[model samples]
Target: MRAVVIESPKQLHVTTLPDPTPGPGDVVVRVAGVGLCGTDVHMLAGEFGPTVYPVVPGHEFSGEIVAVGSEVQGYAEGDRVAADPAVYCGSCHFCAIGRGNLCEKWGTIGITMDGACAEYVKVPAANLYRLPQGVDLGHAPLIEPLSTIVHGLDVVAPSVGDHFLIYGAGTMGLLYLQTARRNGAASVSVVDLNADRLAVAEQLGADHVATSADELDRVTTGWEVVVDCTGAVPAIEDAFTRVRRGGTFQQFGCAPDQEQARFSPFRIYNDEIRIVGSMAILHSYGRALDLLAKGWIDSDTMITHRFGLDEYQKALDTFSQGTGRKIQIVPSLAPGA
Candidate 1:
């Protein structure tokens, strides 16, 4: 088996490794496609902590089940599936309350555990969801991130005919735009410092796009809802001020652990603004898969590059350049291709 490992910050190496086998109640999947996400960049930069060195780094993925443990039921060999990388302790207080994403002892594949960046990866049977018929394996990797956006929308409850202003035009931001539009936002606008990303956002159905933070004033301040996907301090701070007095503001991006944004206490007290922070997907992976399987999301358009497992370093370099919206690693490529 071939796998990509990050020994340390700024270091990605592709090396031959032993293939994985399923444990009791687990399944082994032959890697089909693995999506590179922003979190992977953060992990590579040593920003996100608790990532084990020399670990395989991928979570958003799709694959075919090659082996299933005897204890695993309702699944078998040759089944096409996508995985929910978030592993939660069912006994935690959050999990007891049906908020597994917020579980105190939450662990995730590709971060806290070895992930699907290799020829074969082992996952708990409970985490595997059967892919819908007719859904290509190439696009199955998108279900995880798309589910995050769907979870955020579920929390914010953006309604029909509402005007939405989304900060950042990156992959998550663009996904938010499409989700908001699908939820019936009369007009959805996206803001990003990168004009290229804003163009991509417009192509994805954002009614308006802004490349400048100051340009937000041109749009109505009375936006019905504002979502911040940038996670930058300045952008988060601006979101607090740009949302309408009574509008909802949702924070869907992850900021640095040490970074903080200040807001006026008086304004928050007087404006009646509702601010919500949405974390990772909570029981939304199924819905994300359903949407993808049903053709609600154009997953093919989101994928910009695909590389063989042996080309993992090149994939990392391409991801670091920020030129592609989404990149996937295909571990089952034919020899010499």
Candidate 2:
């Protein structure tokens, strides 16, 4: 098997490696398509603190099962599936309280273990969610990221008819826009530095799009739900001020661990504003898959670039340049290969 290995910060190598074998409770998936998220970028740059080096860095992925563990049931070879990368210590205090996302020993597939930027990768059978009848593996990688966004919404728990103001029209931001509208936001507005992204947001059902929140009309007091998906310090700070009184503000993006943003504690208290942080996918992967199968999301338009596994570096480069929506790695399918 061949895979991409991050030797260290700024060091990457793609070469042949031994095929993975399923343990007693694991299954080995034949890699189909893998999506790269901002977390992968941070891992590659050594910015993600918990990432263990010499690890394969890909978490948002979709594939088919080729081998199942002896204890595995319900899933079999040839089953198209998307694996949830989140793995938590089941005995932690947070896990005991039904908050596995906050487990003390929280770890993810690509970040903490070898992942699917290869021809084959091992996954826990329990984490596998077989795709519904109509969903294809190509677009199914969106499930992982969408699930996280779903959890973000769960954190906000916004009521129907509430206005939503989202910062960042990147892949995650656009997904937030789609889901927010579906969740009954009266209107969804998007802000991004890129004009192209803002345009796509509008085409994807955003009521308004702009390079800055100040450019948006109406809702002058603020929005009922304000989400920051860019994770930039400035954007996070700006999003804080855009939340309407008694509204919720969700920090959904991954910012540098050392970075900090300013916000008004007085305003939060006086206006009854709620500030929450949504981590990665919780129990939302299955829901995300079901939503996609139900045609709730436009997956086709969400994924904009695909490359072969050998071109992992190229995928990273394109991602860094911020040229595409959801850039992915298809182990066997490179358009111009």
- Alpha-carbon lDDT, every model: 0.84, 0.90
- What is the model-wide C-alpha lDDT for candidate 1? 0.84
| Predicted candidate 2 versus true structure: per-residue lDDT over 242-275, tens digit per residue | 9989989998999988788888999989999998
How do all models score by TM-score?
0.93, 0.97
User: Over the stretch 220-255, how does candidate 1's per-residue lDDT look in tens digits?
Assistant: 556879889877889999877887887888988877
Instruction: Supply candidate 1's per-residue lDDT for 79.
Output: 98
CA lDDT, candidate 2, residue 181: 86
Taking all chains together, the TM-score of candidate 2 against the true structure is 0.97
* Candidate No. with top lDDT: 2
- Alpha carbon lDDT at 150, candidate 1: 87
